[model samples]
Target: MTEGTSNDSTSDHLSNNGRSCCNKESTNSNILDAVQTSIDSLANKEWSNVESRVLVVYTGGTIGMVRNNRGALEPKPRDLERRLRGYPHMHDEDLAKEKYPNSPFLVLPLYKEKHCIIYMIHEYSPLLDSSNMTCDNWATIAKDIRSVYKMFDGFVVLQGTDTLAYTASALSFMLENLGKPVVITGSQIPIFETRSDGRDNFVGSIIMAG
Candidate 1:
C-alpha cells in the first residue's frame, strides 16, 4: 500500500461484486467474523486451497505514507510490515483504526487478509513522481514484475495517478500468461493529506490484485 491518509473521508473501501457491503465503524468486526468464521470450520490455511494465488507487489502509494511531526510525509516501512502482521481483519478494535485516524470509513484489513506473498518495491528514482513518468521508468517497473513473475500467483503495481493508466496499459501488453491480475493504482490525494484518497485506492488495489 502507498502512504497517505486523509481524516475527511467516509467512503466504504470494502465491498463484494461491486456492491457496497460494509459499515465504517463495524466493518472489521463484521468481516473477520464472516471470513474467519466461514473458514474456521475448514482445515488450516483454507486459503492455500483456493484456486488462485495472490501476490501483493506494493510499489509505492499513499497507503505507505506516515506523517512526521513537522507535517512532512515519510514512508514507514516498518509500520507496513506491522499492519500486515496485525491482520486488521482479526478484530476491529486493534487493526480497524484508520491509518490516518482522521477518516472513519477508510479502515483497512490488510493487517488481517493474508496474501500468498507481499513484495515492497519503491520507485527507482529518488524523486519519482507520476507526473514526470518516463518509458525507461516504466520498463524498470515491468522488469521487476517479470523478474518476480514466476514466484507468485498474481501481481499488484502501486503507482501515482499521473501515469497509472499508461503504466497499466503498458503492463498488460508486456506481461504474458495473464493468469492473474496485475492491478495498478494511486490516490488522487497524497497519503499524508488529511483527506487523501490513498487508503481506499490502496485497499482497492490490494483487493483487485488478489
Candidate 2:
C-alpha cells in the first residue's frame, strides 16, 4: 500500500511538469514587440538596419489631419509611429485612443517609403492643403531641403497631390546631390478615407527604397 502511494505521487508530479512546459510553449509574443521586430527586419538593422537612411520631409498634407467634433479638418502633429496609425501622440481621448491601438496611416495620396532617412520636415502653417499652398512655400521648402541635404541618404516629400508635380519640379532645381533618391507624392482624397488611393502607392514607395 505504501509503495502504491509513492507511485501515484510520482505520476502527479510528472503530469504537473508536463502542464508547465505546455503553458510556456503556448505563450504568445507581444503584438507591439512583434510589429517592432517586423519593422526592424524589414529595415535590416541598418540603423534599425545596416547601410542607408531614408528621410520623410512631412511638409504638410492631408496625411496628418483629423476631423473636429464639428467635422472640420485640422492638423494633428505627430511622429512617424503615430502617423502610421493616423493619430496624435499621447492623446487621451477615448475615441481617439480607441481608433489607434493599431496602425494610423491615412489613405493619403503620397506615402511611399524609399531607402533612406525618414525625415519629416513640417510646414509651420497649420493647414497643408494644396489649394492653400504657394510659391514662397515651395521655395522655402526647397531651401530647407538643401540645407539638410547632407544629413540624409535620400528624401521623400509629403505634399498635396494636386501640387506634387509643381513641388517635385521645383525641388529638382533646388537639389545638387546627383546622389540618392528624392521622391514626391500626394493624394486627392484623404488617405484615411474610404475612397483613398494611398495604401498601395505609399507601400510601393517604401518597397522602392529597399
Candidate 3:
C-alpha cells in the first residue's frame, strides 16, 4: 500500500511539473506576442513630424585618414565627406536631392519611427592629429558650437582616438550652459581602410547627436 501511495505521489508530482512547464512556456509565448504587437504597431505608425538636425564638427582624426604616397595614413581634406557620401548607410543622397536640394547638409535614411536626421559636416581647415590637439583647439571647437548652438539640435565631434578623453574633458569645462547633446567619437583604424571601425563609430555618434 505504501509503495502504491508512493507511486501515486510520483505521478501527481510529474503531472504538476508538466503543467508548470506548460504554464511557463505559455507565459513566455504571451510575452513574446505582446512584444511583437508593440513592434508592429510602432512600425506602422506615422513619424512624419519627427525630424532632427545635427552639426558634425570634423576635427581631423584617424577616422578620416587616408593612405599617402608612402603608404602612411594621413589626414586628407574633403576625403571624409566624399567617403561618407559613397556610404549608402551614412548618406541618403536621394532624400537630400528630393527635399533638401539647396541645403548643405546630408540626410540620413529614415530609421526607428521613420524620423529623419539631417546633418552638416563642418570640416576643419587644417585637420590635426589628436596628439597635437591643445586647449586652444578645444576652445575653438567650443566657440564653434556656441556660434551655431541655436542652429542644431545636437553636435558630434570627430577626432583622433589619441587624447580623445582629454578633449572631451576640456570641452565639458569650456562649453557652459550647454543644453544640447554633444557626442565625441573616433576610430583606431582609418576609415579609408576596408576593415575599419569608423563606420559604426561615426553612425552611432551621428544617431546620438541627433
Q: Residue 200 deviation, candidate 1, in Å?
A: 2.5
In order of lDDT, best first, we have: 3, 1, 2
lDDT per residue, candidate 1, 1-210, as tens digits? 222232222122111211221122111122223323433443445334443333444445455566789977655553544454344432243422322222122123444344322223333334356667665555555555444444444556666666778876655544533444677777766544558677566656655555
Error of 2 at 25 (Å): 62
lDDT of 3 by residue, 52-108 (tens): 877788889889898999999888897787778887888999987766655556778
Q: TM-score for model 1?
A: 0.52
Clash tally, candidates in order: 21, 35, 0
Best by TM-score: 3
Model 2 agreement with the true structure over 155-195: per-residue lDDT tens digits:
56667777777776655544433355666766555555555
Tell me the whole-model lDDT of each prediction, alpha carbons only: 0.46, 0.45, 0.69
Q: Which scores greater on TM-score, model 2 or model 3?
A: 3
Worst 10 residues of 1 by lDDT: 9-18
**True-structure lDDT of candidate 1:** 0.46
Candidate 1's C-alpha runs over 4 A off are: 1-52, 74-79, 82-127, 190-196
User: Between which residue pairs do clashes occur in model 3?
Assistant: none
Query: Residue 1 of candidate 1: its Cα lDDT?
Result: 23
Question: Model 3: number of clashes?
Answer: 0
